[model samples]
Target chain A: MSDQMTEGYITEDGRKIGGTLMEMKNITLRFGGVKAITDISFDIKEGEIRAIIGPNGAGKSSMLNVISGFYVPQEGEVWYKGAKRPQMKPYQVAQQGIARTFQNIALFEGMSVLDNVMTGRLNHMKTNMFQQAIWKGKAEKEEVENREVVEKIIDFLEIQSIRKTPVGRLPYGLKKRVELARALAVEPHLLLLDEPMAGMNVEEKEDMSRFILDVNDEFGTTIALIEHDMGVVMDLSDRVVVMDYGKKIGDGTPDEVRNNQDVIDAYLGVSHD
Target chain B: MFYREAGDFKTTYADDNQTFPIKFDRYRYYAVLFFAFLIVPFVINDYWVNAVFMPFLIYSIAAIGLNILVGYCGQVSLGTGGFMAVGAYAVYKLMTAFPEVSIFIHILLAGGVTSLVGVAFGLPSLRIKGFYLAVATLAAQFFLVWLFNKVPWFYNYSASGQISAPERTVFGIAVTGPNTAAWATYLFCLIFVTICALIARNLTRGTTGRKWMAIRDMDIAAEIIGVDPLKSKLSAFAVSSFFIGVSGALFFSVYLGAVEVGEVFGINKSFLVLFMIIIGGLGSIFGSFAGAAFLVLLPVLLKNVLVGMLGWPTDLAAHLEFMIVGALIIIFLIAEPHGLAQLWRVAKEKLRLWPFPH
Candidate 1:
């Protein structure tokens, strides 16, 4: 069903790496004299897996944070769908079809898996607090409708077994999956993942890779992720941007970036203590 | 076997998302409603209505209100008593000003007025949090009580500095003031309690409730996920105050009939309701009712056992009641932090898996 709907966005290879969705032009972020990102520029196309890969403190997460509206660059123009995005709150960015997962796993630990996902439908829900208090007509109807959407996401992620369990009680890998489920619940046009496979084992990585690919294939969601694992980045991303010392060192297909000397040096040349 | 859901299946989302999902639980809810509406009114007398039922209903409404703010929204408020005083004074002024208006409208308008006051006081919560917000609300409580006491205009310059409910009727039956019958007052408060519970339950289960809980669990994540902290926190205060205000209106006009602002809606009243939510369960409506019933019954039981049957002094029984309430609060906080609601939940879990221990 999703494949048919996403046909216009996908190419022959079933990759929907089409039309520029977000353009970051000369983004320079600063933290009180210390630069987090300097003169970085990139464009993420619709329905593509765009990875920002780098070593520790490489400003990859900072770039993702800028895109997600958690941090606004001191000097830059963020253009989304041909319009320059204005100064807005993170939630406002989410309302504009941008959803993200944190590197540290930002699931609501106190809530059940179902509820954590239901919260992703916050911007989508239109019922006001008054209607909700009464729980009649629109509020109840909207709840059931959103619940159906949440249930579908839960099923897609194969987390039906722990639907009622609190997210805090889940294992680490499962928690990561739940975070993805939550981000997907937003039905975002651009999904940002900050190290989705940060603390996972080999099998967990494979499972997450499958889910990420399936999500892109099925929903045609444009994804932008920051990952440290070079192998996973090479296998999953259509185009990879390499950052080093708050600067963009390389940007191309995984295979093209692999042969780039600057990219290789950033990883291999840097000496460890 | 009794609690099993073998044959019961939900064909729709509404059925699955009901306030009480289990068949047994649903039936029990209906039975309780049935008893409250049909059986209790006929058998109720002055003592039971005044001493037990009325206060429980009123306090439950207040606790439900407070729970939405503190329990659901994670905004600590100690100004509940002040907000309640606003309701009482608003109702008193409205009832006196417009003698021709219905008491119901007066009470509702009072709730609206209290909502405005609640929002004003709740403004600080957007910037401050935790114990700081609590202190801000504590200030509100003291200031409101002082304003009502010192401001003679609030009491119509009666010189006694006390406000008394004038005789009022709903459908030709007196529900407030001296001429009101026990059953009339009981049914009046019961109607409000039922409606309040239904609304509170609905709000807490739906989208608004999710936003509140999201704010409660983690405000930062809630903001990232699209919950506006300002709107969420303030709305919690407004809705919570509305309920508390109505209870205050009932507490003064319907329940007490004559009230001194300082003595009736004091800091102690705030603590009392807070204790009710803590003992009953922080975030559950049923817990609110349970806590109210427990506290209300405690005093009466103490009086019955120590003063009535045992022929002990009334003051001694009152002192013992205080000690018992204090001790129970400590025990509940230590043993079962979630209070009676958690206890009830564990019981249901055990019942569901009866005869089959894992």
Candidate 2:
């Protein structure tokens, strides 16, 4: 498919990583008098691993929040495909094939791992409440089909042993994996991960990096992730967008951002130390 | 050994996801259904029907309804009484206006009418949550009971402000009002209970149930995953109220035969249903029935033993019943917060690992 050209789409290394999927044009977000994101401009290419790396309070999360429609920028036009995106609720954005994982591992604690993943399939379900109540034709069929998809994701993440375990009882690393499985269950065109490897061990980080790469390679899902690990940022991502004090300091390939002097200074000149 | 699944294999998703996944559990459920539908009606008499069976069946339906909202949807509602009042009044109006219509259809319409009221009150849940939403629903409870008491139209301008169910029969057997046979009424209510339980079980095991549980578990996460909080919460309210309404209609027309709004569908009724789910287990259909049965039988059993057998005062037995219920609720909350369902699950797990200690 990469060798077979399709109009405006781009190809790289035998993989299709094409045209702009989501474009944030001069996004400026403010909370009262405090500006969270200031004049941040970036575009996420289709089927590429895009990383937003920054220090604490660098507003990297705020940038992800803006892209997810959680916090609509006070001034900026968000473009999806070629058209300008509208001001809508977070769920409305999800309906437009956008899905995200939370930095805090916001999997439903009381529900079983399987049930939590099933929640991601809510958008694709066409069954009405009455039909579901009666366990009628469409409802039963959809549930079984969705269960297959969810099971495959569970298998993919190698959390099959904890399929029926309540997420509250899971360890931190497994919980993160369950969260990824849930996000993958959405089958989104674009997936957002917020510091997915935060609070994980070295072995867990390696496993998570492999999963992220596999998600991009197999599912062809456009991924926009926020992370602070430089090694992970450089290894897993196709391109990196560096933020410092709510401003875009660097945006390019991992090697390009690695050589950028501003990025070097931002990491070296830490006031806290 | 009793709960072994060594040879049982689920070949498909539907088999795995069925309401009763285990072969033993499935057979046990069928046995219970068989007893309720075929055996009990014939053997039931006035004493057994009035003292035990009827109330259990009716309250089980109501508990299932409330559990769906409070347990599965994670929306705390203190308006069960108000919603039930809507169903009772709706059925009253339907019965008086359309005498020739089947009583079953009137009960169904009563459920529909209550669903509308439920949705209207459920609007506050969209903005408010937790204790705030509970208080809002409490306001609805007071308002609805007051409406039925003050409004002459609801009771049809009766001087006593009482609405009574007139004679209604099905298949040539009287099931409502005076002269209705105890077995006839038992069978009637049993039929409704069976259907409601099946529907509730199906729902709590399906897609909408998952959505409700998701919203209950974490609304923000559910919303981020494309669950519309407004739709999920309101649909939960509607469906929960629909079953509650049907139970209320049965309570009035089939069980009690007459009702005074304040005395019957009051705030106390709301607490009773809430307590049922808490004791049964949150997020479990079987828990609803278990809690209802536990609560209903407690008083009757206390009365029979403490008052009838021991010759104790009636008030003493009644007071003791309250103390026991209160103590049991606290115990369940502290020790087994998952309620009776968790206990059952533990027992089944033990049985599965019998002849060896894990």
Candidate 3:
């Protein structure tokens, strides 16, 4: 594993996968007496689509929250880029090259689609209030530069037609796409998506799957997504971690996880004492 | 036909991101500026200046400030009067202490002082929100009013506890105090209004504006997107207070020339500014101006029609004015919560598609 970390590896499809981008070691998150996620550990590698698959109440979302710095685990540290990440505010975590979308859409409904996407570039805009107030040289140049990046993402996501429309007015699938565009605008090294296809139709799901793959292929962004769709997990992810009752039940490549007896038993409703 | 953007094309991001992207709206803005600076100053008399122009311009600044906090930033502050008092008192002290300095500098300095106080008061906003935050700001209103009224230094140890602006000048023309010409006062406030509106507009359309709106729209998402809530909320409070303070300075120095803190900068004044934004439209620069003009004109219109023409009692007209404003606010909230700015936007939308309905 250490040798592979230095040399990298080529997948079956010939895509290069880099060393560990983020590793969660013995993470235990609790809410009062209830453990939302207990003693779960996983690592997401660079340039690979990783999936966290599980049944309802499996703490998949909670694990994603911990990675995004929304929650701090009771035990163990989150190692990112081979360094232990100190517990910080979610915004601070976001500034460290991490971005995410929520289970329910979290678009700023009052603003235009363009404005919503521009917000993803907040970490990049360096102009102060005084410069922005005058808006002549530094502020104007920064705005245009950031606008170019946002526009590229918007074009890539094919949401240019509704650029000026308010986010609240858009349909759910398009809003999800805008959210993705916003997260992509961060140009993050690691993107965590929480239920990207929660309420989509068959066609919408297929489109989302394509976009996820395209994002991974084109930007080489490491993605760790929590998905319920078994087909989507098998097709999109290079490796899978399966969880049930706030515990990791299986972890391997999609084929290995599919054949793991524990994962099958968890899916088949095995009785627990 | 004139309002349409059919022939206009923006070839660059800067052009597309301009305050007024359309040629017609841009021209209209220039026209308004030309008229305000060159036209209105010439024909204005004392009655027009005192009753119409001065209050309109001063309140417009206040409205714009309040709109930044309540309208754009979505932080409901009921402490406009308190913040304004800070400006008024600060200017009063500055004017007396530095009698030789330009009144413009005093006003600007007063705004700076008020921003500090605003930020101090704004600290509570980090932990509280909605009506609870409003209550927090309400405490600021009452406490500030009390401080000004009780403290002798605030009013320069005046026998009546009233702070009055001494005669102050710009380019040898008296712009404050009793001896000033109508045009000097009008142009003085007009200058401040122009600068405030320009700054407000620029800030709201730029990165700062986006941060404020992001926090306003959804705070958790804004945080996760890397917007610092401390910076955004505090900046909103500070900037909002600065404008309110400037207006307060102008209110005492130019508009009224003398003010008692308790009666002038009280709970009622806070509500008045809040109502201006609510009526004018939240989150709109034009709405601030529109709301200010509407409120200022409402009283004059009521006096002329109810008392001047109908020979009704003055007090009755005042009562009727309150009733009309209350009813309009209710109607606006229920029917058009976006206020007059949205109405103007819808009207323009229709004008763009005129002569055909699909």
Candidate 4:
């Protein structure tokens, strides 16, 4: 792990992964008495797709929540960009350029898709309430500037047609796309996606996989995603961290994780003693 | 046909994002403003000004304020009447203390004072939400009313236990007090309503509004997306309170000329504003106006029809008015929960696609 951290590896497709962007060290998270994640340590390299894979109740979502600063691990440190991250609210973490999507689609249902995406730019918009109320020079200029960025995201996601449509009326696939657009609107350094393709059909899955790859390739964003689909995980991720029953079972390239016997047993329903 | 946006292409994001994106809507808005400013003042007598326009305009401000919290921000506040009392009392103190200063400055200061009080009450919303938050604000309502009633300073220790608007003017024209002309007061309130509506519309459309709506739709997600819940919620309270306070000041100083805090700014007042937003359409500026108009006009219309036309007793007409409002509230909630604004929106949408059904 130290060797890999010092000298980043190149993927088979020859995309150079940078040094560690985020590192979790000895993370132990518990909800009262039940341990959600126990002693999980993994590093996400910059400009690489990192996957956290586990079966149901394997604490995959919990790990994502911890990364997004929604859940503070009972023990262990979170290091970002060579500095130890402090205890902060989720919004503060987002201000530090960490953005995530929910397992359940968390789009603002009452708002238009454009508005929902614009919310991701909240950290970037700096005009005070007074300026916003008057909306003449500073507020209007800032809004238009932000709107340009949001419109780009909407265009990139091919959601321009539904820009003015309320998110509650959008289909499942479109909602997921809009969520991705929102996350992208943040211009985040590290993007965390919790089950980006959970309930998606085959075509939707393919589209989402393409979008994920495109986001990584275009933005050079460090991607940390929790996914159930083995095929998608193997194809998309440069490194995979396999968890089972609140423990890290394996951490390596997708090829190495697939070959690991513990990972195989965990997925194949090996009973715990 | 005229409501359609077919050829109305926006060249820039600014053009696209203007309050009224459609050219027809923009022109219509301008026409309304022109009529309100120029034409209405000349035609409106004291009866129309007092019975219809003043209450509608003042209540519209209150409804807009409440809608910011309840509709746009998704914070259910039952303390609007309390906040309004803060404004009324604050203005009474200001008006009496600084008699030479402009009434406009006093009203704005009153709103500022109410916003501070609102923020203080809004503190609990960070921890609680939904019905519980509503109840907490309800406490603010009762406590505020009680404080004003108990404190002598609020009513200036008048023997009558009421605060009356001292004569005040704008540019040597009396806009307040018993001697003020009907047109002067109406025009004064119309200016405020227009300004408040514009400010409310701008705030709700800009980044602040987005932050608020984000907090409203989903707090946790909003927070994760970088919207500070504390700032957003408190700002909603502050802004909402400001508008409510302004209306209260206007209601006292400009509209009614004298007010007793308990009788006027009571729990009923809070519910009235809430009903306006709910029946108007939660989260819409136009809904705020629509709801205020519906409520303010309903009683007057009822009185004229039942008492004047049918020759029914006034007391019976009043009771029937309450029954009708109650039934309408239930019907609106059940049938069109978004209220009259949504109905208007659907009509416009249909109109845009008229003469050819898909």
Stretches > 4 Å off in candidate 3: A1-7, A271-273
CA lDDT, candidate 3, residue A36? 88
Among residues 3 or more apart in sequence or in different chains, the pairs in candidate 3 whose N, CA or C atoms overlap within 3 Å are: none
Candidate 2, residue A230: lDDT: 88
Report residue A247 deviation for candidate 1 (angstroms). 1.5
Report, for every candidate in turn, its global Cα lDDT versus the true structure: 0.89, 0.90, 0.92, 0.92
Of 1 and 4, the candidate ranking higher by TM-score: 4
Q: In model 1, how large is the Cα lDDT of residue A265?
A: 91
For candidate 2, give the lDDT: 0.90
lDDT of 1 by residue, A1-273 (tens): 121121235443665466788889899999999999999988888888989998899998889888878898999889998799998888888889999998888878878999899999988899887777778689889999999999999999999999989898999999999999989999999999999999899999999999998999899898999888888998998888889999999887788799989988988895667
DockQ scores of all models, one per candidate: 0.69, 0.81, 0.89, 0.90
Winner on lDDT between 1 and 2 is 2
The CAPRI category of model 2 is: high
Candidate 2 lDDT over residue span B140-221, tens digit each? 9999999999889999998889999999889888888899898899989988988998898888888788888889988888
**What is the per-residue lDDT of model 1 for residues B12-98, given as tens digits with 9 covering 90 to 100?**
988878988899998999999999999999999999998999999999999999988998888988998999999999999999999
Higher-ranked by lDDT: 1 or 4: 4
- lDDT score of residue A32 within candidate 3: 97
By TM-score rank, best first, the candidates go 4, 3, 2, 1
